[model samples]
Target: MPSPFTLAITGQSLIHHDIRACVDPGFLQIVEILKKADVAFTNFEGTILGRHGGSPMKGSYFGYSDPQVLDALKQAGFNALALANNHAFDLGPPGILSTLEEVRARGFLHAGIGLDRDHAIAPGVAAIRSRLIGLVAMDAGPGPRTMYADNARYRRPSRPGVNQLEVTRIFEADRAAFDMLATIQTTFQISKLERANYAQPDDPPVLDEDAEIDFYGTIFRRADVNRRVIAVDPDSASIHLEAIARARSREQFVIAYLHHHHWEPNWRDVPDWVRAFAHACIDAGANVFVSHGTPVLQPIEIYKRAPIFFGLGNFIFHTEKGETEWSSPDVWKSVVATCAFDPAGPLQIDLLPVALGGEERIEGLDFHERQVPMVASGKIAQQIIDDLAERSAIFGTTIERHGPTGRIQVSEGQR
Candidate 1:
């Protein structure tokens, strides 16, 4: 039988500062958990500013980290990183290239943004003790198209960007609302202007009498009731699945990851579309599926013996001190999941609750001391596990609590 392998997974790491010098007991405890695992994975949430110097693509919200932060993550025992996210292109193409260079130089197994379309979509593979682990990562965005990588064509050059899984937001309207929108469109002669200037030759065909109308770039579909629907482009999804399948065929334990900004009205609620896509990834031979975008933890699902984490929230969030958007306590509380896979036995997942600074006043701490995750205990730990259990129950995933930790055991028969 193959030897047992343990994988430690954490959420987004938007770290900008170094913490290798910190001797906090709580912080060190969190690091110890990661060190015990054969492989530890987290999403690197920002671009590394390196030799290929680049300019910021956004205003103050732009995310660019110094190279020393990579050293900090390595010190924290993270061996695998997912680099596909909204902020991956904060410093533009140069940032992508620089990050790729820095991560590769450190001997880290990283995937997501790459030199071109094919490279971005390819899996990052590395051999652990007794298993080969592969990571296929992507971003489903509400971001600019320029942020995504594309292949070199006859005339255009390849773009160095994130591996993008195209997603379309369709607004569903009732018959009356649909007709009113069409009337407004015709009255303003918007179609004429779009056809003459805005619409591309490859744009989806628009028919006045059809059930769907392309109002500018947004799609409005006629349906029985008014609602919003998130649609994943079939071709884009197929491409990602193909990469996962290819990696699995190579006998690698595949971990499929997605980073997206499309959240439900309630940040903690998992979107149906995302759940469906996670299942599709498991169907395509992904041994584990994880996602991180929303700053709060969502739900978990166990499908076909594979664990699916809809959103793992923030592991190491180092946002600006003045940023009040992440003030919610839920955003600061999350769990570190460790999955143990034994070839001759069952799969066991242990969850250790953690708090980012643990109810401390954000204004009191220095930049270096703030936003670092520590192991949670007592009431804080119970609260985190209870919330996670309640949400995960929606997907029929049961979590048994043991003191401050949670556990989920899947028998071999489930596989």
Candidate 2:
């Protein structure tokens, strides 16, 4: 609504220390490109390690960032961040509190982690120029239960944590798989002694060919037919829908993002629940949908005139000195997405390749060994384009390469 605007986005960035000097000259151009966008977003993983100075907290060190290092992010032009990641609570409540304080003081729009459910789930809006843009963020699981935000009753104070999308797992199988699973579950059984046996009910058993069998609180049918099922908690979906509608009323552009480790067998493909969630977001009035968590790029889906990036991989896949166990070679490569939307023209999307690695840093600022996301070239760049083109093909999304970057082709009707 405010003329033609562009949004540049990226994947997860994990920095435990300041990295102002980590980026080389070529990569600084990409930072400038991000600075020039109307709105720029990224998945800001970890808690802002502020006030505590360089002192470590009582929880896991998986996600702890020095507060001063945020200046480096500000220098690179990241105005918006999503914070409902697995490591949001790695440093516990104190870390969460510090992160909120720093992010607000820096004047960046953020969503997800907060002191209560409403605070965590609420959309963070930014009035950039004359346009009001809103963003809502959540983390879906098959993940650590302790990371979820407290939704305690009015009388009881809510705990500090990240926003959550509840996940209910539904397991299904045919006759053979069902029987095999039952047999396996039986192996862990503890036989009851004769003296420990309790009185039985007088009611007769209800048995049918397609009858339901209850084992260890899991229900399965005896039928031979094949069935596929997924359980997305209705309450969580409804809350997200409500948030989207509320944001739609006050803003010209609404962006929704989710962070999850849920994935399918191919690694590049997303879970069915994620697809359903994306569709639901569009139905609820979101202009763009994005997902991350798995440190590799997944497919892009087009739904109801909106774009959904299932996963954007890792924009800065740095491995800290104490984080040797978290190392993965594939995560070092990623894409910087440039999205253009016009009220009178077709939408356009482009991706620039990046490689995360650097040795330079400011003196006396070393909280941990850090690596910067640099501009990628040669095979590193080519692989990212090829992977995106191949995976995005499933949704009829096309990508073209012109050296180290690629362009996403979308027609007027599709947008």
Candidate 3:
């Protein structure tokens, strides 16, 4: 065994502008912590769509910025990056190719996007501190067909895209909702017959056997209801588990990471499938697990002696543009996670609360502009620590104040 090793983890990073010029001093201190770790990791949220190549999606936008952002990340101590976020396929194949080229050229180990599903699902291996580390990044969603990597056929190759974990949404309507849908089906039948009599070539499928949806046509609206469950596609989970099992035999540690925008009824708790997936990976021999994309800190669970971060929020969230960038408060805060693991297992985990800063955010529009992540102070910092402790309590994890950060307490036996 290579003694004990520490892994520093963080959430999404978007370095659209120059980090050195736009960021402040406190951000550098956080970087110093990351540098001290055996391996430092973060999810790269934006894509390098190049200067003049890609087109945006139909209604929504995909993240794209200068390719030089890779250099900025290297300076921040990110030796490895998760590339399986919603933005992976933003610029199509060219973007995917460009990203892989730049990231690899910069000497960063990244996994997620690939030319086909096999490579996409495969783990990116790194030899850190004489111990082999394997990483597999995936996302359940924030959807569009373009974002997922496709499995290849006998001859034709699969498309270039991000690794995907398919989530099957199962609708379990109650008596009222079920009856209403049935009524809609009956009414739609009459309309279909009328359309057929009126010389329409084909009417829409009233009852979709696969979808369990009763709708008239393509243009329809479905209200938010509780009679449904987000189920993880077992095939996808098993595929990843198989990879982890293989890596475990050959490597010293395996880190499985997921990037999804999915959340539970309250944005605080993790969705059931997320928990299930984390446990499955640990069972398959993953030493550490990570999740991001909620953009807010959502508790932590120590599963089978391994740490599972459901959502780490933003390590560096300098949102200059977004639909609600001007109003959303959740984007301004997050934490930096530090984990110390020895050959036996994990020893200690620390959560340091940090606040995102810049001109756009802060004491209103009057604050000076700069993109940086400052160690939160006073009331703002305590509030984050308190909320995190409350959320993590369900998993039997405790948070005690240690200077400006919170030390996540785990049983000594659990280590």
Candidate 4:
């Protein structure tokens, strides 16, 4: 049983959600559960910086909780956090800088994003029970040019900066022909893009090919790794390689948390490019691939000897419309809507929340911890376990339950 290393993991995003609430009981619950664990980890969902005067993204919101949040985590007995999720850069460079500062100040280890290209690509290391554990964080692909961390305490990058990867795929069979047609179409899309002295190709699918090929071709060519027009999306092969490299380092074990957005359940809705992106992560030596951004809980599957827990859902979304996805039956509806659940199986993870009023609390927080457990009591926990078990059955994975309290270990050799 691998020495029965007691592990109690929670999936809570660190965005500003009811931050001022009391959380002593919640922290104590975690301390009680993970007392014997060699290490404990949580998902730092939001960027940790004070909301200074920084421009938020055009189509999104930026956030920053007080630096004390990191202290709250330390008090709760967490050793590390996966910082590679979607909202990591909600507030740009300043937020990123503050997040790093807070993490360092708290003597906690974080990974998945960094100050510059080099730092962002690097992995994080922490010592737990004398065992060195390596942590790596990555985004799905490239993002806007105007994104970054911007805190007054830290210096910002002067050049055009982007932290996400932008990758596309092409099938070997469609390469040469697709390229020929795409070149012509590319000329038509932007007449100025064509070289004045260059002769445009007179191909059958000139317009169609040019439109498809030009966009995909240019992007793929940027990295110079694409051959045929197989897929189109921002999935960076370089980041995948980096993750692989980081995981290969000598450590007790390597766990990577990547920020990607592929949470569709419909077989047809599941894009081929999305699967390819996930495959790239798996190929990169990632042991556990935790995905976010779909904002819903997906199935837990083992891919290429690694356990991939897609869409851990939102852990601490203060901005949610009302109740959390877990508190609402809609999550279960989505679970059943996309996949089936096994009644006689264990739960996927120990779903825990960061309750309020502990060592990590702000002076103004009014959060109450007693109400949280009362809301998710034994009966509710049992229901969640049953629901998750049934869903696991659909993926040929068995999730059995030996009791309640939202603690169900996924037995091996059951698929």
Candidate 5:
């Protein structure tokens, strides 16, 4: 193991148009740089699962890379991947299962999602020498309702097709039986809860009793056949707890990779749930919280001695043709704005080269391209680093920006 370990991270990137050329040789170069360090981590933004039947959700933009992408990461020496992101389930459970199978077969560790909410909270941890490393992945925003592993209908062979649920769902026939059963289960659970708590029998548990009776009545009264009691909402809290539990089991650094951000610059306000989740994760013993999903990077702060990296901007898309527009300094201002400099002085932070792999060209042809014209040329990457350093000053982020290399040197803050 390298004496001083280094790791790198980036944002959501896609290679939909030309999968092969998308990951250039520069990717290998980046990996070579990272190889000098102990381990490297990154978010696998696209799914590599082999399944094809899961109903693509409405209004969903899906991205997928060949399974060989995993081989590329191995060649690049990337040991871990955060799979808890929006696209992981684009093909539904089959996609997710295939992804898990592939990752396992490749001997790579992944976490932040699973067959159910419980799996989402458990993290992938690898013991590196005297230190332990953990990775978590989570997503925010709307998407398919994640079903648990044991849910009856979603079992191995036969499962209802999944699609991105529209804001307004019209009645569909296939959903009827499941909806009825779900109503029954829900009613029973509520009745059980009422019986358990039955506080001040006079009130008789207002929410469930009448609701249960009404639910049963409604099921019988309804003509619609398509009401299923599917677990629609993503239940991630338990997963979060389980992940922390795994981290604690190991005597090493605990890092959680979350795909959802607690705040966004464009959004004037931060959601309370977001803030609570971050704080809650920290309280549960996560040493570092790395979050993604926001197009641009966000702030990085240490709450209760636990650092939260709100976002890591897109790194692999530099070479892709159309995305070149994102190379501007202004677009990366948030990354510049939140970088925290080590107090000691200008010294290189452990730089790890994590590469984008596979093959594809800007013109959508299969070919090996090493350098992304915009970033490989150094001009844009350097400017992005410089711009971030400049903006970060406003946030009191004291970082050391190399003259034009965009390479970061974090200080230890004080002598």
Candidate 6:
């Protein structure tokens, strides 16, 4: 058996500034925790605009960071990065290539975006302590279809983009409600207009099921209740699972990562589909599963002795000034989780709660200074741990709060 290993994981890092010179005590404290781990992992949530120049493919909230931001992340001790997120393609294919170039130049173990579909779906491997660690990263996007990697076909060349796990939002309505929508569709000739203006020959034939209707681009299915359902593309799921299995077959510790914005109505709630998918990845051979996209912490589950973090929220969130969308206090509270894997013993995880800029706004601090994470202390620390414990309890994963930190120990036979 290989020697015991330690992995430190953080949430999304939407960084836009260079903070290598910051001397804030809180920030330094968080950095110290990360530096102690053998492999520090975090989702690199934005594209890097470097020599491979590209135009913005998005409108408001376009996220593209300078190359120096990687220097700051390296300074903060993040050696493993998941480079698949909604903003990964903010500058289109060129942006994907550029980000890959910069991240590779930094010598970080990175995965997710790649030169083509096959490349993007492959796992990234790194050797640590004479043991191989593999990461398979993907983005479950509710974003544009054009942002995902595609292979060459016919006369078209392959595209460089983020590895995407396609997801579909489905709305289910009862018979009465379904009929009402159908009546409106007929009255307004909605389907006719859609066919005339946007329908393509290759568009999947509308569901022939009597009770299902394709309204505009949304799928509405008939059911006994009114609710929304999130569906993952099975093919995409299989592709990622195969990558994990291949890594596992090579005797590597596999870490499966996902980034998505298909959040539940309540941001704090974990989506059921995401839970199922995480379980599937674990069953396929992943030792650790982590996801992000929602800007607030969700819950953690210990499934079959493998740790699954549904959402860890933001670690380095640098939003634009006056951005009220992510102004919630919960968005700034998260934990830096360190997991220890011992071949002869149980897996132990320590969660160190952190707050952005000490949980209070400083009068003179700018975005970069105020948004850096600091190790949480006092009531705020307890509150963060307590909330996480409450949510994680739903998964039957008990987190023992030890003052400002939380811990979980899963024996080899726990599952």
| lDDT on C-alpha atoms for all candidate structures | 0.89, 0.74, 0.76, 0.49, 0.48, 0.88
* TM-scores for every candidate against the unseen true structure: 0.94, 0.83, 0.87, 0.65, 0.61, 0.95
Q: After superposition, how far is residue 298 of candidate 3 from its true place, in Å?
A: 0.7
lDDT of 1: 0.89
Candidate 6 wrong stretches, greater than 4 Å? 192-206, 362-369
Backbone clashes, each candidate = 0, 0, 1, 48, 30, 0
Q: 6, model 4: CA deviation in Å?
A: 4.5
- Candidate 1: Cα lDDT at 405: 96
* Candidate 4 runs further than 4 Å off: 1-7, 17-31, 34-36, 50-53, 148-163, 168-235, 265-284, 320-328, 331-375, 405-415
| Candidate 5 segments whose C-alpha is farther than 4 A from its true place | 1-4, 13-28, 51-55, 58-60, 147-242, 261-276, 302-307, 317-379, 391-395, 405-415
Q: Write the per-residue lDDT of candidate 5 for residues 30-118, one digit (tens) a residue.
A: 54554554555667766664654354533525556667777766565556777766677666666766777777888776775565544
Model 1: per-residue Cα lDDT over 1-415, one tens digit each:
4688899999799999997988888889989999999999999999989999999888877989999999999999999999999999999999999999999989889899999999999999998876899999999987777888989999989999999999888899999999999998889888555753554423543454568887776678999999999989999999999999999998999999999999999999999999999999999999999999999888889999899999999999897766666656778888999999887888899999988875453323443346588888878899889889988988998899999999988899884
> How do the residues 279-389 of candidate 3 rate in per-residue lDDT, one tens digit apiece?
899999998889988877888888877899999877765454434433445556788889988655446888877877832354453222436677776677788888888
lDDT of 2 by residue, 302-390 (tens): 77667898888877655645544444445556788889988666777888887666222312233244456777767778887888888
Better of 2 and 5 by lDDT: 2
Better of 3 and 6 by TM-score: 6
Global Cα RMSD, each model: 2.5, 6.7, 4.7, 9.7, 11.5, 2.2
Query: Tens digits of per-residue lDDT for model 6 on 251-361?
Result: 999999999998888999999999999999999999999999999988999999999999999898887776666656788889999999998899999999988777665
Ranking by TM-score: 6, 1, 3, 2, 4, 5
